[model samples]
Target: MAELSPTAGESNYSQDIQVDEKLVPKKGLSLCSTRYGIALIIHVCNFIAAAQSTVINITMVAMVNTTDHQFQFNGSTEQLPGGPNNAPDSLPAEAPTYDWSPQIQGIIFASAAYGMTLTMALSGYLAGRVGTKRVVGVSLFASSLLIIFSPLAAELGLISLIATRMVQGLVQGSIFGGQNALWERWGPPHERSRLCTIALSGMLLGTFTITLVGGLISQTLGWPFAFYIFGGIGCVYCPFWFILIYDDPVSHPWINVTEKEYIISSLAQQIHNGLLSALPFIIAWVIGILGGYLADFLLTKNVRLVTVRKIATFLGNFPSSALLVALPYLPPSYITTMTFLTLSCGLSPLCQSGIYINALDLAPRYSSFLMGTTRGLANIAALLAPTVSGFLLNQDSEFGWRNVFLLLFAINLSGLIFYLICGDAVVQDWAKGRKLTRL
Candidate 1:
């Protein structure tokens, strides 16, 4: 090391210090560190967030499938033990589901998407200043309350129910707003894929768990219980989130120098938009183990991270969409069509690893905001896609479905081209900020 001295240099006054002398040797990576503890909690948080969103898929079935269960509360119908929060084993045989039309059902299905689109942009901006913990926690808690009240809204009338769902959508839409920042604070550069994947997969896991558990609860206790139970879980999780987690390594009380330094040093280097975050679970639900393994395998092979991600995006978008475009024109063969559909829809590992985790690659500091923008955009798609599909299918013919798939194909192709051309992996200039240093 060269020391600065008045006589050594006329203008310079700096000393050269060996970096290694000031650094501690890296410890072995562990699965059960404080960072991971945070990840586990976040995973559950995501699970709650996702379950509330997806449980709707299951609960709606009991409401609509029986057609007879009009939910009249005619005194003859028994409300569950917990009141509106629980549904009976079965609706009375002659009950009708409020004489709801398919169009109304479609509108209800898309309400959350609209609400989500409205808030995602705002949420991202909030996360940057207020911190991820507060934004996500409050958003989730609020969304849970809305879910609990969903059945109550249903009881009032169709318009009331739509209003309730829109609020729920807006609430839940903000839940993902801070996820990218949260990960940057917690994730070490090298371990981001594993840590982020595991944490984010909670939503996917929630979706899966709901399919299994929601059915049993809706079948045995009643459909309202699904919303109640899911909402309650989120409310319960809020305390733990506030108590155990902080914005960054420096603020976390339980972390040690070894881990803190490691995390800080690593992050010092480094969404779904909302739908993107939800994609891994989609792939996992559809493709299962093989897709995940394929993603990890490529990473292990020393492939450039950007190339790996690009490949994943290409795989996810092109073939599947192309298949959808061709399906309507194909010969009448169920096995062939089914095969095409399964591969196209089910296998999406590229999305799981590529677009889903692209936040870290772009700008780690602004990731939350960036993620929010993407999520907002994605919700716009969510809102529009269904409407478009419905419009195309209005004719109730193969031709209508064909048009729907064709539109999707065009959209997918455009996204693929844009991503290929504009997507990147290098850490961007915006992320080189002091604000990100802490979290």
Candidate 2:
């Protein structure tokens, strides 16, 4: 095997190295070659799934009004004569008719997170056995089914909705895990940073799309139809996934010989080590927890509406108008709460990608494992966020949001410290001091 070595005077090394034509591996589609395209598709899928998740938060009021027997709005038990409220008017309508407890709502919101916490821990093991493509495919398929069933659960009861959400959460976790693994396997070292940015950015897009679409759908066709739309979109993407993706470079026919050589040579140095060594899982945990709380804090505090509006305007007038239309329909308290939540949630993925990309930089071979570990730890944070927030909110509803924000900020600052201290140097000097090393 020919090994690369730095030399003082050698130029045109590519021409000097002679090998049997048969021995030189032919160029083929590799992680480096196909990463951008595959990652793009994965991002699209993630966005659809994420949108479904966030959209429901906005539609909670509409959903309860339409489906639940015990739900009431504005202190009046009187049923609307027509519209989405199909429940019988004769049903006993009393004061405190709908039991919309924060605990119950927390359970509904937290179900997916609980599943994510569990699945992310085990996803690496599962992906090792089934391959990343299968893992992602199966998870997305199951999630699509669960999302389709979510509205049905709403029709049944809050418990049923929670159950479906939990299932969906598990599937979502698996998708995230598998996607990360796939990227590590396929992405080139040079492109890892940009690829991570693009892949993670999808979460924001997904959140925005879901919130905007959910608001529109809930306003027009009612809340259940929102799930249908998201689910349908997910299903449509599955076939494309199946057709376009391959598990490894050897499996892809479209890759060229030069690209394959580049990928193998680039990754050859790092593939033999253990998978989790380079990951900053602890940092990820802190970031995830703080990010979740920050989002909740923003949702509850509403301090950045002007900034948010400017952002929305820069993006487009349609999205800004959509937010305005949706805000009035929501309870005044929730409007600001959800807005901040959206921004915070959107920001978390970027933070996560930044941390995970560092792991790849530190150990390219073990990138998948590091990503999985970090993701698992982060999911735990996601699971705990709602519960902690609930506890604080219960103690003092007025000031609890600020407390959460403060806590999140402190935690994130700590993570930033770790990042500064531990991030890998861009170029590693593996050989130094020895006679051969000096060469």
Candidate 3:
């Protein structure tokens, strides 16, 4: 067993690395390989799942109008002369109406996170046991079924709709939770940052597709089509994913000898660690693209991988803290405050390459479990954001927003400090199921 010197944080694979001839190609290191294909598959999986997750938002308005309720656009809806449908002037059959209290609507909206928060860590554990591809594949396929039935659930009653959303939330939470674990096997050592970033960027693409395409679809085709379209996409992708992917290099039938050996050797040095928190996913895509490249670029320069990780973390999150602090004060202009907030969201990418992938950096073996734990922690933040925002937002007052921004600043500051001193790139002792320590 070759071991890297304690003093040097970089890998020493070039000289000492060994490959199994059975798995290695006769030719040499090649750019286009089975690994990149897996990355692309991951991209599609995230894209479909994410699109399914959010497509409901666009369809909500349409759902409200579809079920036997009267939508009055021009004049008051009044019952006229005769009894029932025979009334001389009246138009259709009378259907029951449901009321949406502000509180009830809030509950319905929050139902997904309720499930997500509960299942975050559990999802990761499942990934290790069953394999990440299976876990994510099952989750998405199940979520698609729920989404397709969503309209029916809405019409059945409020309870049914809420139940459906909660289940969807619970199921979808694991898609991301399992990614690090899945990649633990699929990504080659050198390609970890690039591949993780690229595959995860699908979340951004998914959301963008839904927001722009979903809106148009719902408007022209009706609300049910939106769900059907997105859900169907997920349904279509599942078989392809299962057929193509495997748990790790050793398990993949098509992976060549060289690639397998390289991946296995890479895993030997992979350590387990954790950092980074969740941001609203749409905002994460840009960060993934920019941060992934930046981290990989720095790694090539001989900067200690740990230092590179921290730099990405600090660069990504610290400015957002400052920007968030000032956001409330941005001269009452629409664009000004909005711009500040956008930049704050934009800077989040630094952490994508930074602490986000630290789980893989720390412990390649347990990456999925740690990734799930991180996601669950992020879901707590996601769960809390609405409540805190509600408390600080005043429909007519700026003071409410001021308090919110201040709270955000504090949260970012806390994370920044935590990652700066404690963040690491070295493999962790606990990742190997041994004793744990901080260096």
What lDDT does each candidate get?
Answer: 0.62, 0.52, 0.62
Task: Please give, for residues 1-439, the per-residue lDDT of candidate 3 as tens digits.
Answer: 0111211211233322232222344454545778877878888887787677767654443333321112121123432233333221221223222344323543565577546644444666667678887888888889888888887887799999899999998898878766657775666544555576667667667766776676467556666777888888888878988899888889899888777876786676554321111223334444546676777788899999889988988888888778767754544454454456556766776676678667766764444335434543454454356455544442312355556667887888897898888888876665433222335
- Candidate 3: regions farther than 4 A off: 1-31, 65-102, 272-439
Q: Write candidate 1's Cα lDDT for 243-304 as tens digits.
A: 88798989988787788886776544231133433333334344523544666799899988
**On residues 3-29, what C-alpha lDDT tens digit does candidate 2 reach at each position?**
111111011122222212223334553
Instruction: Give the poorly placed runs of model 2, Cα more than 4 Å off.
Output: 1-33, 66-99, 272-411, 414-439
Model 2, position 418, has a per-residue lDDT of 59
Clashing pairs in 2: 27-256, 27-257, 28-255, 29-255, 31-186, 70-98, 299-337
Candidate order (lDDT): 1, 3, 2
The whole-model C-alpha lDDT of candidate 2 against the native structure comes to: 0.52
Off by over 4 Å in 1: 1-29, 65-89, 92-96, 269-439
RMSD of each: 22.2, 22.2, 21.2
Error of 3 at 264 (Å): 1.1
What is the Cα-based lDDT of residue 25 in candidate 1?
Answer: 37
